[model samples]
Target: MSLGTLGRYELIREIARSNDIVYEAWDPQLDRRVALKELRLPDGISDKDKHARKERFKREARAAGRLEHPNIVSIYEVGEENGRSYIVMEYLEGETLRQRMDREGKITPEDAVKIFDQVLDGLAFAHENGVVHRDIKPENIQLLPDGRVVITDFGIARLQFEPSITVDGQIFGTPSYMSPEQVVGRDVDPRTDVWSCGVVLYEMLSGQKPFTGDTVVTISHRILHAEPAEIDGVPWAIAHVVRKAISKDPDDRYSSAKELKAALNDALQGALTDSMGPPSPWGPPLDPYSAQSPYTYGTSQPPGTGAPSPPPPPGGYAPTGASPYGQPYGASFPPNMPMPPFPPGWVNPPKRPLLSPEASEFLLRTLIVVLIGGVLLATAVGTIAWLDRRSQEATAAKVDQALADEIAKVERLIPSDPLAAQQQLTELRRRAQSHATRERIERLLSRAYLERARRLLDAGTTDETLRQAAGLAQRAAEMAGEDGQATLDAGKLLYDIATRTTDPQDRFDRLTEASKALEVAFNSEGQVRSEAGTLLGNTCLQIALLFGDNKARSSLYLNRGIYYAEQVGNRKLADDLRSRL
Candidate 1:
């Protein structure tokens, strides 16, 4: 059926959805096609709610119209016709990220990082301009055929200057990607969008959502209490960044989208610098500055491949039509020019040669000499560079050996007086000349820090002492630097300190850190894996106790505790915890 026109736009056909029909429409004023979304209220909506929905519909236009970033969808106009609100936007030729994910299952880690980087860029700009995209999901992110990603649907975005239309305790957004605070109807900030970005990145790389449940209630519970399983087949740096971005506590997450983007950039430093390999099978070449046209342009050549081909000749083809002269041949001359008569016995002139044979032979001889000279020069330079590199490596190795010896001496002090050992290792780390030496120093430093923190905790449980111990323990975890045994000891120390904290929030934060470190330790076949598992189980129980009112979350944690307990061969402890269930 023909839907007729709204304002200047002629509705061509319904694109998708009902109730709020998005149509492929034509704009007569600009002679361009656009996407028109009409505001259609549900049949049973209240009058006040209807008015609010209308305002919200128009607000999408207002929100997006203010931003002009390349990754943001362009809004043309918002208007009302016959008491119906409609928005006109540039029609993009591409599928949503959701559709792409459904077809491809998952994106390559490299390409996923690229897409994630762009999404964060767009979100960072939106956040800087005081807009929080509360409902960031794959369905709302558009991936153009040119590999250009655009964020759409700002209908639920919270603008800083505007009064929020949301009723208290009302929740908005997809359950799987909502932040812990967002799932519970708490006040949200830029970090809420950061959480969603993390979920999107995880899904893109892992082919699954980090949090999943059959119902919204169950999903929300998981979001609030459950730790996401580590993503497989990705670099530890990348996985670590993802884990931090999706922390259950907003305060523990990156402060803003910009910060998250920076962290991801660091994690992706090498991948971004290396060749992006083949062009993405998901899209065409990325052409952010191409002119708008109904017809798509460019081949599937990857970005940075080379310049585009030149346009066709003036009339769309080279002058291959009838010639002005008698002979049948292509002509560059204009068709309007009169033909001149040729003199009798006239012959076509021979083409002039650029150089005589004698001159060409001389040029070739000189070129041969220059080529030989160039090769000799390159070889000489390379030999010198190789020798210099060798010398530098030798010097570095000697320095590394000296640093390692110093670290060995400090290792003895760690067992007896860790504070003094930490001071020495910290000083030695500054002069460490290689990655291995630095890593060794860090591992020893972690032990020293953990031992010192343990001593402080034993002295007393005052707030000052607890704070000091927690700080030291956190440093230990950080300095452990991927060493499973060191990380386990630091984690166990942190868990011990966390359980003694008086403040519930403080306890929760510390426990989260302790569990994160322990999780990393437990994954490795380290000496303390069993101890790490037992403490991890206990930490889960503590978190469950904190969520006493929410039985779903509590029960979820209880089950996790029992599972971890069994993994460590503590069947009695597992049974005891299971009885609580």
Candidate 2:
């Protein structure tokens, strides 16, 4: 059904959503179509919830608007007409990855890898910009006719340094794709997206989902406690890489999307041999199961699939049918260069014989005799290598035991003697040899520092005490390693301590530090977002007032403060900040 016009755009049709409506609109200025998502709440929702939802929708627009990439959906503008809020974005005419999977089950490993490579590339860019896509699944992936893959739906994205829209203890994400931390109501970061990407990869390489159940609760349980079944008929190295990406512990997973992509590429290089040809680039003609030459949306489907293909869009553009890697379609291949699979039935002719049969046989016999001598000598060397390996293993075992004992001892001290725990953890961190051990130590230290800071802030409000607590809290935030509970707690403590200071210079310096810490906390899931935004806005305003001589700098601070106040729906604060202008 046609909805009313929103601004200059005419809404043509409404796309389906449970609690919202997205209209397919035509933009007269751009002379093209666009998608306009209206932030309308369903009936029966409380006024408080409706307000929160509107704020969240605005946040989605702001978060997505900051990103500019070929593989990411582009936001054109965000506006409100009367009381209705709407977001305008580039209209995409394509099928979702979920639709493609339903049409054709289980993509080839090589093609799946290509798709994953692009997904990770987009994710890497988003992470670099400090946005975390909390919900990533096949449904959120759109495949264009021109072989371009786009990630859609930033509705649940968390922007770094902005107070999170989601409330504490609220679980929001596709159940099957949710990371363990997410399933258990813990804070998320780039690693959370990495886990979801791994789930998508697993589904693409295999016909089945990594985690599935009849109910959301059941699915969440599996996500938290169960391991995915092994992917069969895929390269062992590639499988191993995916497994690591989906580890139960965030620390065990790839630290970032870039790291995961690198691991996947390395695994692919090791799994494929030269003779079998390089893996395909991200595009069409890679589908071997399709009758259609280039498998695309609205094209011919595989036989006996029963589902009918949708018609192509009007004035649909043809596939580029070219590699994105700066090469022509049929260029002479360079050695070790990864390329798409050759067209069906194409084969390379055998090379001409280098020598006569008798000559080759005689040369082979001579090589065998040399190889035998080499093997005898290698055996003697291997024995010595084996002894050294045994000795190293024994030493590693002892170090591991000692490290465990130290960790346990520090854990006991964190509650009553956090200062001592922090000191010991710092020392232990230096001696930690394993990645897991270092991660554990860092987490413990953040907690210890946070506890100590909290206690100090609770005990007194003296200038000296405030400074001491601020220092400890700052250290705790640094050690928390991004979007942890300790980081959020430390940020609040730092801000509280800074506000208690009476001296202007002291307050300015302390608030500056608190702002940095709170920026990170703002992007985490919690009920403190509104509180953080208020404090941040106030801090910026205070700083501006202290240095009112520089009009340009003051104006900048005032505008930023206003933006934050408005973001948290504090219209009074926003107006107050604006009155200064």
Candidate 3:
């Protein structure tokens, strides 16, 4: 059935539906086929909210469209019509890697590396050009019949030159594939994409996510703390490389996609030979999973399960012929190429089944009766559902208003009654929109804790109080999560605690923490940019002072302190640091 037309494009049949609908379309203007994608916003969202989201989406999509990489899907154009926004992209004739993974189960090591190598090359190019693809997964990667691997979806990629469109402290990503820093809402550079690549590569080898849980919270905690299980059917050499690529600490992993690709090539050399041939067009089919499989969703189902029976979020019964990628299987046409026409007479859909006259008559009567009953029942149900929905919405609105008021109050109170504000924010989480608002609330709470602790220190607190205050400040910094203001506040608190601590070990630890936090503040236009630099430099000086007779080490800190102080026109501090030198 025809969906409708947008601009010069005619959206014909819908191939899939999820958070968005992917439609096979004909671009009459270009005389070519395209895939038209449209977004699906949540119900009850405000027009302003919808508009803002669409605008950002258009901007990002347009930017991604400009990318000229062969392996990236080329968005031919983006447009809005009838209050709906869509992108017309070069359509491919293959299936997603997700479908292949489900169909083939785990892939051969050689095929995995082939796909990984191409992906890494494309990503290396993208990163060099300042694009960081934040969302990379089996679902977003596609495979072609000609043995080409293509990366799709730049929906969440950060164009480094552009300011972030997301709100401060608001997190956006698929939970299972998220990097460790991404999970904690920390500052993400291109290294984040490397971590996600490791995850995709692992899934390609093992047919399972290394880190997963029943809920987002559980999964996030695991990504942050747990080591991935060893991949079966692979040598320790391959596993070792995978483990390093997915290291929880970004500092420990390869610095770039190019670096990762080189390492993968080295690992593949010892264990794999050229005889492996091209990868299977698809992976293992879905069936009753073994007791050993980590993923349990739809595992007990027979092969060729039809559309799945309804289940709770992230769990459901697999239906016949559904692709394991959580959507109907089809290749997203490769980027940078015009799509060939669909097979001749593709418009001919499957015919409807026929019924005998007697059976049709009996079915018609039964359907009429059921239709009458269904209408009556629907009326009653609709009334009940409407009332229930209205009541829930009202309650949610009231709670949201209350939460907003609390946020406002906390912002006001944080300057003076911060301890109370911190307590209030902690309590407000009970009413706050759980994952939707949790990050923002956490950052606010971080500021509250930092403020209260700093006030205590400023008022001449005891040694125990200083220690307690420093701990609070540290938690605050963690919760600040790349927000400039919150980081600066927490950084200042850490610096204060570091300066006052007397013990040898405690001072070193506090100074280390202080230096880290203050560096972030110095990088941003934090309320204490110069102050953060001075404190960070001073922390370094304190560490150097411990070296005692090590003049070279002490001189490094003294020089750094003088440079920072001079940066802000603080001659007095610079001179003092120079004296130390």
Candidate 4:
């Protein structure tokens, strides 16, 4: 079908194309994209088949449109143009999990858990609204740059939506991830999605599909009767969760995504506690000195020693500057108590040596002579020392000022032209380093390198960019103290690499490094709480996304994001992400 325009949306790109129709299109007018599906009538095909296909498109669009979760990709307007069917949807920028896995092998446990949680959160939302995602697989999941997980192609399985598309008894969905009931064409429920999620998780963790065979017939048989190989090297809790999720009998598996999520959460909590130890205790300790009394003076006894005083004032009369009961000048006594002796070293000043008049006259004469001579010597030496110090200070100050100015310029240019900023920073570093300002120059240079690394990442290809970014970040981290912003930025850069990279092992290592850096940042006390929290959330998200079935880890990412946002006063962003859940 040719859609000249769908509302305000101008067709920008063709997304999905098949022999029967152009399945998806990008729309610009409504700022929303749509799927344009053509209905092709072949010779000998009955009119009933044509009507059924159209009806199926409408049904699927309607069902999927009702879903309202951040992670569930939404379908907007549905209509027909030029005898073809179409449905509009929100535009997405990320590749499918299938593409990612295909490119990078298995996902890390962190990435798996994060992506799985997003899928499950979307599925759970759908199930609560009485909708089931029959085809839940990696291809239907998208990982957005803003760290969002989007589940797509909902309610669009060909057989389920259109009876005429396939025979009733024929199986649908990606064979390896399909549940037994789905393969056998039995009535299914939300557990079907849970089972599919399990398969996806297993594939993510193991880098291989749970059930595989050379023939469809054998694969179907395996789905019906075979047990998947034990998921070795994965967290035991996660393996257990996947096993239950993919159980042959629907009753043996989690009843819903919510149940599966709970189990995952438990596992994540256990893992975090086991790995990080318990949280610190709250509030301050009791003071030990608040109750102590002041020491007495004339009596010569400490207040807390409980020693008896020698006696009261000799005449029972107050001395000069003493109160009526013989308290020291301006002293306030506790009610019902007689004043004690003033403590030693309290009221009286220390005595000084007495000089004879004649000796004092001679000393003054000698002091005047010595002072004049000493002044002359001191002035000469002080002048030279001051000049030398001033020269060094001026040089140091000039280097510092130049470095600071260059750093500011580079920082301002980073978001616009990272390469230019990097070059400029390198020049500034060279200038500073020539002046023997290694520490200061290295820091600025490292920051510039980090910016370049980030830009490289945006340009594409994870490996080279990630490695470069990580190297620069680590250099910055090592040069700067643990709690310094440079170190934190380094950790965050490494984390971005881990999260964006497709390689499971690389992702794991990157995340591990990032986590350690974040820990250092948290412990630094000088680190911004909000930045630390955000990095922690990002780290957890990567970990969970890699792990697959651990919903708790994913939730922790969400929670940490919220916490850090609150700490940093960016609660709106946190709320937006959490709203998807």
- What's the count of clashing pairs in each model shown? 0, 1, 17, 36
What lDDT score belongs to each candidate, Candidate 1 first?
0.78, 0.78, 0.74, 0.66
TM-score of 1: 0.47
- The parts of candidate 1 lying over 4 Å away from their true place are 270-581
Q: Which ten residues in a row are the worst by lDDT in model 3?
A: 344-353
Give the per-residue lDDT digits (tens) of candidate 1, residues 439-528. 888888888888888889889999889989999998998899778888888888888888899898789778877887887787787457
Looking at model 1, residue 406 earns an lDDT score of: 70
Evaluate model 4: give its lDDT: 0.66
Q: What is the C-alpha RMSD of each candidate to the true structure, in Å?
A: 26.8, 24.3, 26.2, 36.3
Candidate 2, which segments miss by more than 4 Å at Cα?
Answer: 274-581
**Runs with alpha carbons beyond 4 Å of true place in candidate 3:** 273-581
TM-score of each: 0.47, 0.48, 0.48, 0.44
lDDT of 2: 0.78
- What is residue 143's positional error in candidate 3, in angstroms? 0.5
Best candidate (score: lDDT): 1
Q: lDDT tens string, model 2, 1-581?
A: 11336887766667767556888886756667799989878877898899889988988897789999988899999998878899999898889999999999998877777887888889999999999999999998989888888898888888998887778978878888998888768889999999999999999998899999998867875676556677878876778788888888787789999999899888788667642344434322333323442333455654335434344457753545556676543334444445554432221222223345676567558757888889998998999999987887677657766889879988999999998898899999998766567778888998898899889878988888888887888788778776545556776777677778888778866666666666665566545677767766887787678656867556766887897788778899989999997
Clash count, predicted structure 2 = 1
